[model samples]
Target: MPGPIWTSPAPPGNPAARRAPPAGRFRSWWNSCCKGRAEPSRHTGGIVAPERVDFYVLNQADDASRLGYACMIAAKAWRQGHRVYMQVDTPGEAEALDRMLWEYQAASFIPHARTGTPEAALSPVLIGTECAPEKWRGMLVSLTRALPEGAAECRRVADLIADSQDHRAAGRERFRAYRAMGVEPGTHEIRL
Candidate 1:
C-alpha cells in the first residue's frame, strides 16, 4: 500500500484558521508520533522531525555534473547510516543514475537498487523516477524539476538545482513549495 499524503496545515492568523500548531506543540506531537524510535535533535531538546529541507545550487550547468553531486550526496548520507531515496525526472535518468552510482567515485561504494527491484527493500540507497518508498523514511534527494511526493515524511530533503537561469527559476518554485509546506529550507551554493 502507498503511504499517506502529507500536507501542511494552513498558517496561523489566516481567516480559514486551518493552521498547524505552534512549533513547540508540533515538536511534541512529532515526538509522540515517533514514540520509541525518535532521534533527539541537536539544536533542540525535542525529537527530530521532518522539518529540514535543503536546496543545493550547483555551479555547473551540465546535468551530468549535477547527477555526480547527487551520487556524492547519496553516498555520504549512506555512510552516515541514513537510508536515501533519489528521485529523478524520468526512467532514463533513473537508469543512468543506477549505472553511475556504481562508478561515480573510485573509492566509494553506495549500495543501492532502483524502486520495485526485489533488493530495494534491503538497500541503503534507492533510486526511482516516481513514487517515494513507503517504509524507508530517511533523506530524500530530488534531481527532478519538481519536488518529489512524500517528501514531507523524510527527515531531510535535498533539492539539486543547476546553475542555469531556467533551472534556478524552477528551483525557486520548489523553494516556495517547501515554504508553503511550512519548511524554510536552507540553501547551499556548491562550487562543483
Candidate 2:
C-alpha cells in the first residue's frame, strides 16, 4: 500500500458552511432593492469567494507511480470542491488512468487529447492545469517541487518503460530483415 501525498485537509471546516446565512430582520432585508445591485455586490464582494484548488496530472504511460500521485492530488482537490481533469493520449492510457482513479476513488475522470505524438509518451509528461484568480500557478509549482521523491521515481519508471519499448522495436526490425531475406526470424532463448 502507498502513503498519502498531501498532509493536511481544507481549513475553516466546510467551505459552504462559512457562507453567511441569509441576513435576518427587515432592516437587512430593507437594504435590498433600495440600493443599486446591493445583493449582488454583497454576495460577490470577494468576501466569501470559493477557494480555488486545481490538480493537473501530466502525460503518463503505463507508470502506476505517477498515477498514484495524481490520485492523491485529485482526492484532495475533490474534497475541496475543485474541478479535476486528466489528460489521456490513448485508449490504453485512458484505461490505465481509469484504474488509477478507481483505486483512489476520485470524483471524476475527464479525458483530453495530448498535443504530442505517441513517441512523446516516453518523455516526461505534465498532467494538470491550474487556473485561479490568485497564486494558483505558484501553488502548483510549490506542490510539484514538494513531491518528496515523486519526480525521481516517475523518471526512473519512465526510463525503464522507454528502454523496453526500444528493445521491442529493435527486435521487430531484426525480424523484418529476416523475413525480407526469406528466412525464419526464429524464437529468442531465455537463460536462467
Candidate 3:
C-alpha cells in the first residue's frame, strides 16, 4: 500500500459532507478554475502549433487533490494516444503520480533529460529550494527502481513535467516583456 501524503480538508463531525479523495476534488476545481472567463469561440484559425493542453495551478488548498487532478488529466490524454509530459516537485510526489499513471497501463519509465550539466538545463517545473540535478536523478532512479513494473510509463510522467517547465518559462518571458513595455496589468481592449 502507498503511504498517505494528504489530510482531508472537511471539517470534523460533518455527517452531511463527503470525505473525498484527491480525484474527487478535481471536479469542483475544473468547474471554478476559469469562472467568469470568456469562453474562447471557434473560428477558422490557421494551422498553428498543436494546442498545448494546460492546467494552471497557482496553489492548492488541498495539494493531493490538485495533484490527483493533474495526474488524471495527463493519464486521460495519454490514453487518447497523445504523448504526455508530467512534472512534480518531489520524488515522493512523482511516485504518487507514477502510481496513477500506471493504473492506466501507459508507457514505462525512461530518463527525461537534456544534454550538458543537469543544472544547466534543469527543469523549471521543479519549484522550491535549489537542488543539483544529480540529486534529482538519484531520487528518481531510486523511486522508479522500487516500482513493480512500468519504467516507460514513468517517462511519460517526466514528459508532462517538461511540459510544465516549458509553460513556466513562457509565462516568465511574457511577464518580463509585459513589464518592460510598461503595459498596465489587466485585460485591455485594443481596436486592432
Per-model C-alpha lDDT, please?
A: 0.76, 0.33, 0.32
Collision pairs in model 1? 10-19
Ranking by lDDT: 1, 2, 3
Q: Candidate 1: where is the Cα deviation over 4 Å?
A: 1-49
Candidate 2 local Cα displacement, residue 158, angstroms:
18
Query: Which candidate tops TM-score?
Result: 1
lDDT of 2 by residue, 1-192 (tens): 995553234434566545645545554211211211111223224332111221232334335655565555445543443333344334565566556665554455433222234522432222332221121211121122212122111101111111135444544553454334333323423211
lDDT for model 3 comes to: 0.32
Of 2 and 3, the candidate ahead on lDDT is 2
| Regions of model 2 farther than 4 Å from truth | 1-62, 105-192
| Model 2 poorest 10 in a row by lDDT | 152-161
* TM-score of model number 3: 0.29
